[model samples]
Target chain A: MKRRDFLIGAAATGAFTAAPHIWRKDTSLARASNGEIKVGVLFSLTGTTGIIEESLNKATLLAIEEINDAGGINGMKIVPVVEDPASDPATFAVKARKLVVGDKCVSVFGSYTSASRKAVLPVFEKRDNLYWYPTLYEGRECSKNVIYTGAVPNQQQDEFIPWLVEKFGKKFYLIGSNYIYPKEENNYCKKLLEELGAEVVNEEYVPLGHSEFSSVINKIQSTQPNVIFSTVVGDSVVALHRQYRAAGLDPDKMPMASLTTSENEVAAMGGDAAAGHFTSAPYFMVHQSPENERFVEAYKSRWGGDKVTHFVSEPSYFQIYLFKQAVEQLAASDIDPTTIREAVKGQELIAPQGKVHLEAENLHTWLWPKIAMAKSDGQFEVLRDSKEWLKPEPYAAYPNQHCTADGLVQS
Target chain B: MEFFLQQIMTGLSIGSILLLIALGLAIIYGSMGVINMAHGEFVMLGAYGAWAMNAFFGVGLLPSLIVVFLGVGALGWLVERGVIRFLYRRTLDTILATWGLGVMLQQMIRLSAGGELRYVEMPSVLTGTVGILGVDVPGYRVFIFVFVAALFAVTWYLMFRTTFGTKLRAVVQDRSVASCFGIDADKVYSLTFAYGAGLAGLAGALVAPLKSVSPEMGTTYVVDAFFVVVLGGVQSLFGTVASALMLGELTGGLAYLWNDTIAKALVLLAIIVLIRFRPQGLFVSRIRS
Candidate 1:
C-alpha cells in the first residue's frame, strides 16, 4: 500500500483503540490516572465578534492560569482545551461537541453570544455535560447542562428603567441591533414602560455590523425622545454613538441608556462621543471593591496595563473559581456532570462585581446590578448600584413562565 | 419641510460615505473585470495604518492619510505583481484567491495588533456642525462630501483626461492591441490596481474616526460598496455615484417613514429587481470601440 493508505489504516486502528475510552458512559474514569482535569475554553478568537470575545478568552485563560498556580482544585490542575469557534454559531456547536465528546472535558466554559450558546446547548444536553456561559444575554433560557453566570433582564433592566424614567423623562426611544437579544430587551423595556405609563416615542432595529447611523440619528432627532434605550452591540455601538454625537445631539438632554455599551465599546467610541451616555450592567471595571481591585490589577499585569476589563470578562474570570469551588466540594473520583451540577448550585464567589451567587433553583447567577455613566477618560462613573445581589429571573417579562430546578414551568 | 430637508441631507451624507467605499471597487472591478475580493482588506489596512500612525507616531488623521494611501497602495501593487498578475484572465480563480488573501490579511492583522477595538480621534476642526438650508449637518460629514467630490474629480481626470487613462483604457479594452501599440498593458493594469487599492485606503482612513477601527470593520464596508458598484453600471463611474446616492436617499426616506430594518430590506429588493431587469446597470456606456 501507498504511504497515504498506510497512514489512513494506522489512524483507523488508533481510532478503534480509542473508541472504548471515548464511548464509556463516564469518560472521567478513563482520565483518572492523569492527575489533571481537562476543561474546554470556547471563545471566538477571530471574526466579527472577536474584538470583544478576544478579551473574554484572555480573561478565561487568566483565571485558569491563576487556579493552576494556586495549587489547583484538590491537587488536579485544570488543563483547558482551548478552541476558537471563530464567531460562527455552527462552529460553536462543532467545537462544543469536540470538547464534550472528543476531549471529554468535565465542563466547558465559553460563548459570548446567545446564538452561540443556543448552538452549543444541544451538544451539552445530549452528552449530559456541564457548560458554563459567561455573558449578559436575553433571558428566557433554562438549560440543565448550562450554568449561566451572567445577568438576565431582571438583574439589568428591572430597576434600571424606573430609574431612567425618573431621572430622564417619560418619552423613550428604543434602538437595537436586529437580533434576538436586542429584540427581547426591547420587549422587556416595552413591558416595563407600559407598567409605568411611559411613552415609547419610537423603536428601531439595525442589522448587525451596520456602520451607517445617519438615518437612525435623524429619526431620534425627529422623535425627540427624552431617553434613548439602546441595545445595539458590536461595531454598531461605536458607529451609533459617534453618529449621535455628530448629529449634534446632546447626551445631557437625552442620553443613550444601554445594556450593551461597556468599557470595551467606550474605548473604541472615544471619550467625547461616549461621555454622558449611561450603561446598565452587573459590573464595570471601575467598581469599588477589593476583589475588583485585585482583578483589575491582575488582569492588567497579565494581559498588559492597557487591557481593559468589561462586564462579561468579569464573569468569565470568576466562573472558573466557582467551578473550582464546586469541584473541591466533591471527591476527586466522584466528580461528574450530575454531581458537579448539584455542587455548583448555591456556590457563591466574591467576584470583582461583588458577592455573586449561582442560583440553586435555576443554574443562573445572582449579580449586583449597577448604573454608570461613561466619563471622558474612557471609564465609567458608577451612579447607582443595587444594595443587594439581585436574583436571576430568566423569564421576567413572561409572568407566567418560570425556570425552576425541575426545568421551565409555564402556566 | 425642515424634516424633509434634514432627511435629504442625511441621505446625502450617507451617500458620500458609500461613494468613498465604492469608488475603489468601481475602478477595479468596473474597468478591469477583475473581482478584487481583497479590496475590503485594503480598506481595513488603511484604518489600521491610521490607528498606528496616531498611537505610535502622534500623527493626526488628516496628516496620516497620505502615508496610509501610499503604504496600502504599495502593498496592493505587491499583491497585483506577485499573485493577481498571473491570474488576471481567470475571473473565478481571482475571486477565490483574493478572498483567501482577504482572510489571510485579517488573521495577520489580528495576530499583530491584537484583536481589540482601536479608536481614531476626529480632527477638532471637523467636530462641529455646519448649517445648510436650515439644517445642522456634521462638519466632518460636510468635509467628507467635499473630499469625496474632490477625489471623484481627480479619479475622473485620471480615467478620462490623462495619458495614463487612455493607455489603461486601451489595455483594458484589448491587452494584445495595446501591447502592439507599445502601451505596456502589464504596467497599466498594475498601476490601475494600486490606484484602486489606494482609493480604498483613503476611504478607510477618512472613515476610521467615524467607525471603530478593527480587522473585520472592512467587511461591513465591502458588502455595501459592492451593492453600490453593481447597482450602478459596473463600467460607469457616474453610475456608481448615482446608485450610491439613490440607495442612500431610499434608505433614509424609507427608514424615516418606517424603520431601519424595513428600509434595508426594501432597498435590497429594489436592487435585486433592478439588477434582474438591467444587468448592465442603471447607466450604459456609449463609448464605441
Candidate 2:
C-alpha cells in the first residue's frame, strides 16, 4: 500500500509539471481557429541595446495599432504577443522558442543586433516560423524563414565608399564596436577600397559600450586618416563622437563617415559633436516625401512629439505594412507562416524612405540608399540620393557567393 | 617621443576617470562590508539627475552635480535603512539582495525615462584642447585630472581627519564594542553608505558630458570600479588610487603595442595571476581584529 502511494505521488507531480504546457497548447489552438491572427513582437526593451531597441519596439507596435484600427487583414484582428529578450542573445533564443512553440505565433518581428538574430535563427528554422528582421546587418546570411527589409552592405557601401574617396581622400581609417556586424561591414569596405586603390591607414575595434576613446583619438590623430569610416554602434557611438571632437579632430578636414550613426545616436552624442559627421542609410527623418511626412507625423503623434525616426525604425515601421499587404492577399483560413512568406515575396510598399519592393528571389528588399550629413539640430541633411532602388547582395563581399530563392549558392 | 607622450597622456586621462569611478565603491565596500551591488545604479541615478536638470529646468551639468549628489545620497540612506540594515550580518544575502535591488532600480529608471539615450552638454570653456608636455590633450580631461585629485584629497580628509570618520572607523573595526561605547553604529553605517553613494553620483555627473547617459551606462562603470577596488585591496583607499593608474597605464601601453582586445585579455590575466599570489590584494591592511 505504501509502494502504491509513492507511485501515485510521482504521477501527480508529473501531471502538475505538465499542466501549464497542455493548457497553453489548448489556448493556442483555440486562438488560431478564432477570427484573430497572432504574431510575436520580440524586441529588447532593456539592457545595453535597449536605447535603440525600445524605439524599434515602439515602431512595431505603432504599425500593428494602425493596421488593427484600419481593420486588420480581412476583418481579422492581429494579436501581438510582445516579449523583451533584454539584449541578451541566449535570452532571445529562449523567447523565440516560447513564441513559436508555446504561444504558436505564425510570425515574429524583432532583433536589432546581428548576435540576437543569429541566436533566434535556429528556433524559427526548426519550428517553421517566420521572423521579420528589419536591421541593416553584415549581410552574408540567407534564410527562408526571415524577411529582410533592411539594406545590405552593397546597397549602403557601393556608392558610399567611392564618393568618400573622391570627395575626401584615399586614406581611410576604419573603427567600429567589436562585433560581427562591424567586422563584416569593415571587410566589405576594405574590398571596395582595394578596388579603388585607396589606402587603409588603420583598422581597429573596441568592445561594445566602451566609453573611453582617448587612445583611439590619439591613434587617429597620429595616423591622420583622410576619412574615418566608423561602424561603432550603441553607447560607443556617442562616446567616440564626443571624444573625437574633444581631441580637436576636425570633421571638416577629415570627417568621420559612418554606416551606423543615425539621428538617435546624434541626439545622444549631442548635435554639436555630430554636426559635421556623415552617415549612409536607406532613410533619414528629413527625407522629403508625402509618405515619409505622413509616417513621421503619425509616429510622433502616437509616440510623442519629441520622438524622432531614423534608418532602423523606418524599416521597422514599413515592414509591418508589407506584412499587412501580404496578409491581405492570403485566404482567411490559410494564414500560416509558410503561406504568408510566399505572399510577401514580391510585396511592395511606398515606405517613408521611398517605394521599396521585396525581392522574390532572395527575400531581401530593394531600397534607395541616401548619404546625409548630420546638422547641429540633430537632423540629417541629405547630400546624395540613389535615385533608383538598389538590389541587396547578401554576399556582396564574396565574389562567388549568392543568395537565391533556394539558399546560399556558390559557384 | 611624441607618440610615447601621447600614450602617457591617454593613460593619465583614463586613470583619472577610473579613480573617480572607483573611489565610491572603495568607501562603501571597504568600510561597511555590505557588498552593495547596487552602487552602479546610484551612478546611473546621478547621470539621470543631471539629464533631468538640463532637460527640464535648463540647469547645466556643473551646478546640477551638488543636487544629484544630495539626491542620490538620500536614496542610498533609504536603501540602507530599508533593506541593507537588516542584512548587515549576512554578507551573502546582502550581495543577492542588493543585486536584485539593482535590477529593480534599472527597470524603474527605464520605465520613467523611456530608455532613449540622453546627452549632457560640455561647458564651452572646456571644449578645446590643451597642450601638455608637447602632447595635445582635451581641456576637459585636464580638468578631470585636477578635479579628481581634489576630490580624492577631500575624501581622504573626510575619512581620516574628522571626528565622524573616527566613529565610523571604530564601528567598522568592532561594531558591538563601538555600539557599547556610545557610537550609534547604525547611524555611522547609514552615513558612510550615503557618502559613498554621493561620491558615485558626483563621478557620474562629471563624466556625463563625456559618455552617453543611459540606464545601462552604470553597468559598464561598475565592473571596472569593482576591478580597481579588488586589485587595490578592499580596505585601502590609497591602494585604490594606485591600482587605477597602474591598470590605466598598462592598458594604454599594451593597447598601443597591439589592439584593445588582446590588451584587455592580458590585463585581466595579469590581475588573475597577481590575485593568486596575494589573495589579500596588493595592499594588506594592518588593522587588528
Candidate 3:
C-alpha cells in the first residue's frame, strides 16, 4: 500500500482500538421506547467563555433534570446530549452539524455570540433543523430554521433610546469593541438616538479583547457627555469599568449604560466597580416571579450559592425547557427534523423571565425587557420593566430607518 | 490639526510600548541568534510580578515596577540557565521549546487569574491630562513616551560604552573567535538573555496599569512586535525603534479616519510592500552568501 493509505489504515485501527476503551461501560442500551425525544446542548466549556458557559450549562442541566423528574416530558424521558464547542465558532458549526445529522437530535439549542450563531446558521439551514439561539445579538437577521430566544434591537434598543432621552437628556457617547455585533448595534443605536434628538458626542471603536482604556477614558472625560452608551463585550467591559472608576468618574454623576453588561459582567467586575451601572436585558436574577424564584434557587443549589446567574443563563435555561415542550408536543407521533422545527415555531411556554412566545412568522421570541440598576452586591434591582411582552419586530418597518423587516432574516 | 497632533501623540505612546517589547526581542536575537518566542511571556511574567508585589507587599506603582523588573530578571536568568542553555546551537529547537514554554506560562497564569481581566491601579501623579502645544494629551502617555526614550538612551549607552557591552558585542560578532580570545561567551549570552528578558518584564509592568492584566494579553503585543522586528531588521536596535514608531504613527493616524481593522490591514500591506523592496530590511547588513 501507498504511504497515505497505510497511514489512514493505521489511524482507523487506532481509533477502533481506542473507541471501546474510551466508551463508558455503564452506557444504558435501554433506548427511548415510544414517545421519548433527544435534544442537543452545545456550549463552550473550556475556552474564554467557559465561566459563563459553565453557569449556562449548569442551568440547562438543571432545567433538564427538573423536566425529566416532572413526568419526563409527557411520560417519556427528555434526553440531552451535551457537546462542548470549546469557544470556537467553527467548532460550534461542526458540533451543531454532528448533533443534527449524526446524533439525530430533534432540536439543537446553542450559541453565545452572533458569530457563533452565524457559523451554525448554514448548517441548520441546509438540514432545515431547529436551532434556538439563547444570546442577544445584532437585530437585523431573522430565519425560519432558527428561533432567537434572546432580545433583538427593537426589543432592546427601541426602549433603551426613549428611556435614555427621557431620563438623561440628549447627548450620548458611543463606545464599543470593534466587531460586527458592536458596530451594527452601535450604528442602529446612533441612528435611533439621532432620530430621538440625541446628539452623539463621539463614537469610538477598539479592537476586541483590548483592555487598555486610559486614552479612551481621557477622551470620554474631555467630551463630558450626558451619558455613555456602550456595546463593549466580554472581559473588555471589566477593563473599561475599572478604568472609568480609576479616573474618578462617578457613574451616578455621569451615568453610563450598556447593552451588553449583565449579571455575568457584574460578577466578573465584582460588586464595587459595577455597582450603580445601568444595563438593559430581558432577564435579571432578581425578577419577582414564581418561575424566576424557582430558577434562581435551583441554579444556586446546583451551581453553588455563590455563583451569580445572569440574563444569558436564564434564557439558555428557558431554551432547554422550550425545546422539551416542543419535543413532547411533536415527538408523541413523530421524531423527525421537520416536525421538531414546526413544533418549536408553534410552541409557547412560561419561562423564568416571563411568558415568551416564539413568533411563527420570524422564529424570534416575544419577551419583555427589564432595565435594572446594579447594586453593590453584584445583583440588579429592577428599576423598570415592561408590563407586557414586546412583540418582536424583526424587520424594521419605518421608512426613515435604513433597515427593513426583510433585512432581519438570518439566512 | 489639533486632532491630528493628538492622534500622533497617542500613536507615539502606543509605539513606545512596541519599542520596549521589540527592544528585548532584538537584543536576544542579535546576541544569541535565537528567536525567543517566549519574550512576550517574559513581559506577561513581569505584569504578574507587579500584580503579585502589589498583592503581597502592598507596593505602589514605582516600587512595583522595580520589584517586577528584578523579579522577572531573575526568572529570565533561571530560565536561561535551566532551560535555554542546552539548545544554543539548534535555533529551530529553541524557538519550538520557547513556544511551548510560553503556552505553559500562559496556562499557569490563567489557572491563577481565572481568565478575567484585572486592573492595576496607576499612580495618582500619572493620572490626568497635559497640554501639548495646543492640544490636550494624557499625562500617563506623555510619561510613557519620555520614560521609553530615556530607557532607549540608557540601553544604547550600556551596549556601546561599557565593558559588559563590549563582551556582548564580541560574542554576537564571533562567538568561537571571542572564546579563543578568552572571552566568556556563554556567560555573556546568558546575561544578555536575562537583561533582554528583564527589559520585556519592565515594559509589561509599566503598561499593566494602562492595559488589562490577563494571561493572554501578551499574545496581542507579540504579533505586532514580530512585525516591528521584521520591518526594522532583526539585528538592528535603532531600526526596530524607528520602524515601531513609524508603524504606530501610521496605524494610529489612519485609525482616526478609518476603522481599526482597516488600519491594521493597511499597516500589514505597507510591511509587505517594504519586504518586496528591501528583503534585508531597512537597516540590516546585506551579506550575500
Candidate 4:
C-alpha cells in the first residue's frame, strides 16, 4: 500500500511539472467575428539593447496608432500585446512562447539582434505564426515563418564595398564586436574585396560589451589601413567612437564605414564625433522624399522633437502598416495566421525609404540602400542612393548572386 | 619594440583597474573572515552614484568620487551589519547569503533606475591625448594610472601605519584576546568592511567615464577581481597587486597577437594552470597558529 502511494505521488509530481507544456499546445488564435485583431509586439525595451530598441518600440506604437486611426484593419480594432525581452536571448524565447501560446497573438513582431531572432524562430515556426524581424543583418538564411524586412549584405555591403574600393586604396583593416553578424559580414566583405584585388591588412574582433579599444587603436595607428570597415554595436559603439577621435586619427584621411552605425548612435555618442564617417542602410533620417518627410514629422511630433529615429526604427514602423495592409487585403472574414501570412506576400507599400514590396519567392523585402556621410549635427547627408529598390539576397552566393539566384525573377 | 611597449602600457593601465577592484575583497575577506559576494553590486552602486551626480548636480567625475565612496560605503556598512553580521564563521552560509544579496541589489537597481546604459562624459581637459615617447597615450589613461598609484599609497598607509589597522589586524588574528584587551572587535570588523566598500566605490567612480555604466557592469569586474584575489593569495595585499598586474599584462599582450576572445581564454587558462601549481596563491600571509 505504501509503494502504491509513492508511485501515485511521483505521477502527480510529473503531471504538475508538465502542466505548462500541456497548456502551450493550444492553437485557438483564429479570430471568430473579430472584436479585435490581436498582435504581439516584442522588443528589448530595457537592458543593454534598451537605448537602441527604445526608439524602435515607439516606432511600432506610432505605426499601430496610425493604422488604428485610419478606421482599423479589416474594420476591426488592432489590439497590441507588448512584451519586453530585456535584451536577453533566453528571455526573448520565453516571452515569445508566452506571446504566441498564452496571449494567442495572430502574429508576433520584434527582435533587434540576429541572436534573439534565431532564438525565437523555432517557437514561431513550431507554433505556425509569422515573425516580422526588422533589424538589418548579414545575408544568408531564410525561413517561411519569418519575414526579412532588414537590408541584407547584398543590398548593403555589396553596394558600399565597391564604392569604397574604387574611391580609397583598399588596404582594408577590419574590426567588429565578436558576434556572428560581424564575423559573417566581414568574411563576405573580404571575399568580395579579394575578388576586386583589394588587400585585407588585418581583421580583429573585441568582445561585445567591451569598453576599451586602446590596443586596437594603437594597432590601427601603426598599420594605417586605407579603408576601415567596422561592425561594432551597442554601448561599445559610444566608447570606440570617442576613443578613436581622442587617439587623433583623421576620419577624412582614413574614414571608417560601418554596417551598424546610425543616427541614434551618432546622437548618443554626441554630435560632431562621428563626422566624416560613412554608413550604408536602407533608410536615414535625412532621406529626401515626401513620404520620408511625412514619416519623420509624424515620428518627431508623436515622440517629441528631441527623440531621433534610425535605420531599424523605420523598418519597425513600416512593418506594422505593411501587416495591416496584408490582413485587410486577405478578403477572408476569419483572418487567421495562415490568411495573414499569405496576404502579406506580393504586397507593396511606399515605405518611408520609398517603395518596398514583399516578393513572393522568399519572404524578404526589396529595399533601396543608401550610403550616407555623418555630419556634425548628428544627421547623415546622403552621399549616394541606389537606382531602384534592391531585392534581398538571403542566400546570395560567392560572386554569382546578381547573375543567378533562384528567386531573382520570381517577382 | 614599439608594439611590445604599447602592449605593456595597455596591460598596466588595465591591471591598475583590476587591482583597485580586488583590493577591497582582499582586505574584507582577509581581515573579517567573510566573503562578500555582493562586492560587484557595490561597485555598480558606485557607478550609479557618479552618474547621478554628473547628470543631476552637474558635478564632474573628479569631484563626485568622494560622494560615490561615502554613499555606496554607507550602504555597504548597513548590509554588513544588518545581514552579514549573523552569518560570521559560516563560510558556506556567508557566500550564499552575500550572493543572494547581490541578486536582490541587482534587481532593485534594475527596477528603480531602469536597465539602460547611462553615460558619464569625460571632462574636456582630459579627453585629449598626451604624447609620450613618440606614442599617443590617452590623457585619461595617464590620469587613471596616477590615480591608481595614489590610491595604492593611501590604502597601504591606512592598512599598515594606522591605529585602526592595528586593531583590525589584532581582531582578525585573535578576536577573543583582542576583546579581552578592550579592542571592540565587532566595531573594528564593521569599520573594515565599510572601508573595503568605500574602496570599491572609488574604483567604480574612476571607471565611470571610461565605460558605459549599467547595472550588470559590475558582474564582469567582480569576476576579474576574484581572479586577482585568488591567484594573488587572498590574504596578502601585495600578492593581489602582483596577480592583477600579471593577469592584465597577459591578456593585453595576447590580444595584440590574437582576437580578444582567444586572448581572454588564453589568459584565463594561464591563470588556472598557475593556480593548479600554487593552490594557496602566489603569496600566503604568515600567522602564528
Candidate 5:
C-alpha cells in the first residue's frame, strides 16, 4: 500500500510539470503561434510629421484589418502593436527599443524622415530585428538588419532627371529646404545632371521651417531655368509652390518637378496652387490596379470617404504583407528571427504599385515607381508609369561618379 | 566692393524683421519681467490672420495688414487677460506657462490650417528687384527695411513721448508706486502686453510675404529672438534694435562664407563670451528713480 502511494505521488508531480508545458506551447501557438504574429507599427503620431503620418497610420490599420479578414498569414492572426514616436528622434529610439526588446516584436515598420530612421537604426541592429523603412531617403546606406522599401536615388532621381531633361532640357534650378536628405539628394541629382550634360542654374536652400520664399521664388523667377527641380519637404513644399504660382511663373512654361511633394502635400498647397504640377513617387492615389483599388476603397471605408491616400501609407500597408510572407515561409509555430530574416530576403510581393522584389545584397526592394500629375482634387492622375519594376541601384552606375554598389556597405 | 555692399543690404533687410520681433520681446520683458514665450505664436497668429482676411475678402495688402494688426492685437489682449495676467508675479511660472500656451496655440493653428506652410501673396508693388550699387536686391526686402525703420520711429516716439507710455513705463519701474500714483497698474500691464503682442503681429504680417506661414515656423525665431533680447539690454528698446541689427549682420554675413551650422555655432559662441563679460547685456539702463 505504501509503494502504491509513492507511485501515485510521483505521477501527480509528473503531470503537474507536463501540464504547464502543454498549456504554454498551446497558448504560444494560439497567440503568437502558427496563427499569430506580433508586429510593431512605429510612427510620429505627435511630431512635425504627425499630420502626414495620421493618414498613414489609418491606412496601416485598414490594411491589417483586411488581411486578417482574408484569413491572415498562413492561417495566423496578425497582431499589430502601435507605438507613437511623437516626432522626437530620442523618443523614437526609446520606443523602437521598447517595441523590439520589451514587446519582442518581430519587425518594426515606420519613419517619415532620415533623422527618425537614423535614431531607430541602432535599436534594430542591436536587437537583430527586421526594420522596414518606407520613405524616400538619401541613399548610400546598406544594412543587414533593415530593408529600405522606399525609393532610392536611382529609383527616384535617375528616371526623374532624364525625364525632365527630355521634357525641359538641361538647365535646371534646384531649391530645397536645408536638411540632410534634401542636401544629399540634391547633391546626387547635381552630379547626375552634370553627367547627363545638363547645367544647374542655381542651387539654393532655405531653413527647414522657412515660410517665406519671396527671396528664393524671386530668384528662381529671375533665373528662369527650363525647369525647377524642388526637393522641399514638410510645410515648405506648399509654401514654395504657392509662391511659385503667385510670382506668375506658369507651370507649363517653366514646369516644376518635385521629388518630395506627394498627394499629402496637395491638401496643404490647396487646389489652386498644387494643380497641374508633376510629382514622381512609387505610389499614387489613382493607381489602376485591382489591389490598389481595393486598398483605396478599404482605406476610405475605414477613414471616411473624403480621406485622401498618399504614397507613404501604401508601403506601410505593404509592410504587413511582407512581414506575413516572411512569417509564412518560416512556417514555425515559434518564429526564430534569423529564419524569418532569411525568408524576408528574396521575397517578392505583388504590391499596389507592382511586383516588388527584395534585393539580396542591400535588402532594399526593387519596386516600380509611378509618375503622377497632380489634379485639383488632391489626387494623382497617373500620367506615366514604368510598368516594369526598376531594380534598385543605391549607387550611381556612371563611371565618372565614385558611387559603387559596394559603396553603401560599410566595412 | 559691390558684393560687400550687397551683403550689407541683405543683412539690413534681414535685420529689420529680426529687430521688429526682438523689439516686441524687449518691450514685454522690460515691462512685466516675463519672457512671453508665446511671442512667436503671436507672430504666427498675425500671419494667419492676414492670410485668412485675404482669402475671405480678397483685401489689398494695406487692408489685410490693418486687419492682421487689429485682429492679432485683440488676440493679444485676450491672451493677456485670459492667461498671462494670472502668472505675472512669478517669473519662472510665467515663462513655463507661456511656453505651454505657445505650444497649445501652435497645435490649434495646426488643427485649423493643417501642418503645411501657407503662402501670403506679395502685392505687385513688393515684387521685382531694386539695383543698389550695381547689385540687385529684392524689392520686397527693401520695402521691409523701410517699413520696419518707420515702425521703430513710431514705436520710439509713442513709448518715450506719450502719457500712456509714461504710465506703462512707470508700472514697469515700480508697479506698487505706479498704483499709488493712481496709474491703474493692471490696466497699464494689460495694455503694454497687448501692444507688445500687436507689434509681433505686425512683424508677422510683414514677414508673411517673405517667409512661409506655418504653425511651428515660430519656433525657429524664438531662440534667435532670445539672443537678440539678451544681447541688447532687455530693458532698453534702442539696445534691442541695435543688437538685432548687429546679430543679423553677423549671422547673415557669416552664413555667406561658412556652412550655416558653423555660422550659427560661431554666433552662439560669441554670445556666450559676451554674456560672460556683461551678464546684463551690451547696454544697461537703470530704472527710473
Candidate 6:
C-alpha cells in the first residue's frame, strides 16, 4: 500500500500493523558510550487539539535539540521517538505503552488536555516511568509517575479571581466544557466565589466542540450577571466568545474571564474579536522580563514571529531542560525513573516566565501568575502581576462549606 | 408563556441549520444511495470559499453564497464524474472510498491553511439583536429561520414542478426504464449529486460566522446531519424536516434545563427509541421498488 493510504489506515484503526517501529526488547534507559538515548515525545500531531499541541511538540524537539547540541547529555546524544496520539484518549494510551515497552525511552513529554494526561497516567505508573506534562490545569491531581510543571488551581486563581471580584460585581456565571478540568475548576470557583461572599448566578456546561450558543446567550442576557467565568477550551472558545460578542453583550461591561484562554486563542480569534477578554496564566508573551525577552526572540527566530507562544509552550520548552538538568546532576551513565524523579524535586530553571522550581512533595512548580487583557493586536496587556511566587497547592486548602459575608454558612 | 415561545423559536432555528444540511444528504444518500461521506468536507469548502471571497474581492455574504454554490457544486460534479460514478454499485467500497476521499480533503486543507481556526466576520446588518416578545433574539438566527423557509419552498417547487425533477425521480426509481424512455440516467445522477453538494456548501457559508472555520469543523455537523437523515427516513425530504425539528427542539429545551452534553446524550437515546419503533421514519413514501 502507498504511504498516504498507510497513514489513513493507521489513523482510522488507531493503530496500524506496519508502523515500522521495530518490536525491540524492553531495554533499560541507560546511557551508553556508543548507543544514543531515546526519549519518547508523544503529543497530538493531528486531531481536535492538534493546532495547539503542534507548538508543544515543537518546544519539546527544540529543547532536545538544544541539549544534544550542548555536548550531549554526558557525551551521549538524546534521540526522540515521536508518536502522535491524535487527541484520542485510547490512542494516547496505546502510544504511551508503545513508548514504554517498545521504544524504552527514559521518559515521555507531552499532553495538553487533562483527559489525555489521565489516560496515559496509568501506563506510566504501571511501568514506573516519568511523564512530563506542562499545561496549567484543574488541580486536585498528583501522580507518582508524572511531573506537572504547570500551575495548579490555587496558583492560577488566588491572584486573579480576587482581583476580578474586586473590580467587577459580586454575581458570577460559570461556563465551560463538560470535562474534568472545567468541572473541577468550576467546582473550586463556586466554593471560592461563595467564600468571598459573591453569588454564582448560573453555571452551565457544553460539549467540547459545541459552537452554537444562541440559547445560552439568551439566558445570559436575561440574567445579566456580573462576570462570565469560562474554562471552555479549543475551538469552542473562539465560537463562544465570537458569538457572545456578536450578540451585543459588551465584554467591557460584563467581562469574560478564563483559565484556558491565552495568547494562542487571542491570536486565533483575532484581536478585534477576542479583545477585552481577561485571562490568567503563569506566562504571557507580552510579559516584560529580560529572560522572557530573550526567550521570545530565540523562539521567534527559530519559528517565525507570526507564531505566538503561550504558557503551555513555554513550560513545555523548559520542562525538557529541567529533565536534562536533573540527568546532568546525576552524572551517571544510566537515566532511570527514580533518579530523574528525585532530581526533579528541587530542580530550578530561569524559564521565560522568571523562575520555576519543582516543589518536592506535590511534584508541582512554584511560579509567578499574571493577569492580562487581550488586545486587538493579538497580544495581551499585562494588568496584574504577582511579584512573589505562590506555593503550589495541588488540592487547594479550603473548608468544604461556603461562608457568607456575615460569617454564616450559605448552604 | 414567553419562555415557552422563546424555547420553541430556538428549536426551530437550530432545526433550520440541520435541515439545510440534511436536505442535501437526503438527495444524495437518501434517494441516490451513494453515501457521500465527504458531504461535510463540502460544507467546509463553502465556508472557506466565502472567507476567500470576502477577504480578497470584498464580496459580501449574500453574493458569496451564489459563488460558493456554483464553485462547490462544480467541484462535486467533478468528484462524482471522476470517482463516485465508478463505485455506485459497490456499497461497501463506495463507503470506504468516500471515507478515504474525506481524509484526503481534510489533510489537503490542513496542509494548505496551516490548521489554525479561521473566523469569518458577519455583516454589520446581522450583528445585533432584536426584541421579540419581551426577549432579545439574535438577529442572525432569525435570518437563518426565514432563509431556510424560503429555500425549502423553492426546493419543493423545483422537485415537484420542474421537468428536471421528474427525470431525476424517474432515474432514481428505475434506471433502465428511464433510459428506455430517453431520460439520460447519467445526467440525472450527476446533476442530483451536484445539487446536494451545493446545498451543503450553502449551509457552511451561512454557519461560518457562528462557527469557526477549521478543517475538522464539519465533523460535528455531519454527525448531526446523519442522525437527522437516518431517523427521518432515507427517502423523504419532509421526514428530514420533521426529524430535524424534533431533535433540534428536544436538544435546545433539554440543554436549557440541563447542560449541552447531557442534552446531547438524551437526544441520541431518544433517536434510538424513535428508530426502534418507526424503522421507516415519520413519513414513508408509498412508491414501489
Instruction: Assess every candidate by TM-score.
Output: 0.92, 0.90, 0.84, 0.89, 0.82, 0.89
Give each candidate's interface RMSD in Å.
1.3, 1.1, 3.7, 1.9, 4.7, 1.5
For TM-score, the strongest prediction is 1
Clashes of each: 0, 0, 7, 1, 7, 0
Over B1-289, each residue of candidate 3 has an lDDT whose tens digit, in order, gives 7666777776787688788778777778765778888888988888888877876778887788777777777888888998899998898899899899999999998887677655566777877767888876667667878888888898888888999898888877777888999999878888888888888898888877766677887887777778888899877778888888998787766665654556778989999999999976778844333
Which has the higher DockQ value, candidate number 3 or candidate number 5?
5
Name the better of 1 and 4 by lDDT. 1
Docking class of predicted structure 6: acceptable
- Candidate 5: tens digits of C-alpha lDDT, residues B188-280: 777888888888888888777656678887787777788888998878888888888888787767766643455567989999999999989
lDDT of 4 by residue, A1-411 (tens): 699999999998989787755555333434524568888889988777876787888999899988889888767778889999999999999999998888888888899988899999899989878899899987666677887788878788878999998887888999999988898888788888988999988899999888767777777877888888999988787778877876777887888899898987786566556899999999999998998899899999999988777899999989998898888876545576777778888889999998999867778889999999999888999999998889877655444443221333321
Computed on alpha carbons, the lDDT of every model, listed in order, comes to 0.91, 0.90, 0.78, 0.83, 0.77, 0.84
Going through the candidates in order, their DockQ values are 0.59, 0.56, 0.18, 0.39, 0.29, 0.44
Per-residue lDDT over B177-223 for candidate 2, one digit per residue giving the tens place of the 0 to 100 score: 99999999999999999999999988888888888888878887888
Note the residue pairs that clash in candidate 3. Answer: A140-A408, A141-A408, A142-A408, A142-A409, A142-A410, A395-A405, A396-A404
Clashing pairs in 4: A140-A394
Give model 6's DockQ, 2 decimals.
Answer: 0.44
Model 4: runs farther than 4 Å from truth?
Answer: A1-32, A46-51, A86-91, A94-104, A166-168, A272-275, A300-305, A375-377, A397-411
Stretches of candidate 6 off by over 4 Å are: A1-38, A67-81, A94-104, A397-411, B55-59, B87-91, B285-289
Model 6, B75-97: lDDT tens per residue? 88988998999988899998888
Q: Which window of 10 residues has the lowest lDDT sum in candidate 2 chain B?
A: B254-263
- How do the residues A162-203 of candidate 2 rate in per-residue lDDT, one tens digit apiece? 999999999999998888888999999999999999999899
In the order shown, the candidates' Cα RMSDs to the true structure are 5.6, 5.6, 7.3, 6.0, 6.4, 9.0
Q: Among all windows of ten consecutive residues in candidate 5 chain B, which has the lowest summed lDDT?
A: B255-264
Clashing pairs in 1: none
Pairwise DockQ winner, candidates 1 and 6: 1
lDDT of 4 at B257: 74
Assess candidate 4 and give its TM-score to the true structure: 0.89
Residue pairs in candidate 5 whose N, alpha carbon or C atoms collide under 3 angstroms: A35-A76, A35-A77, A211-B211, A211-B212, A212-B210, A212-B211, A212-B212
Question: How big an interface RMSD has model 1?
Answer: 1.3
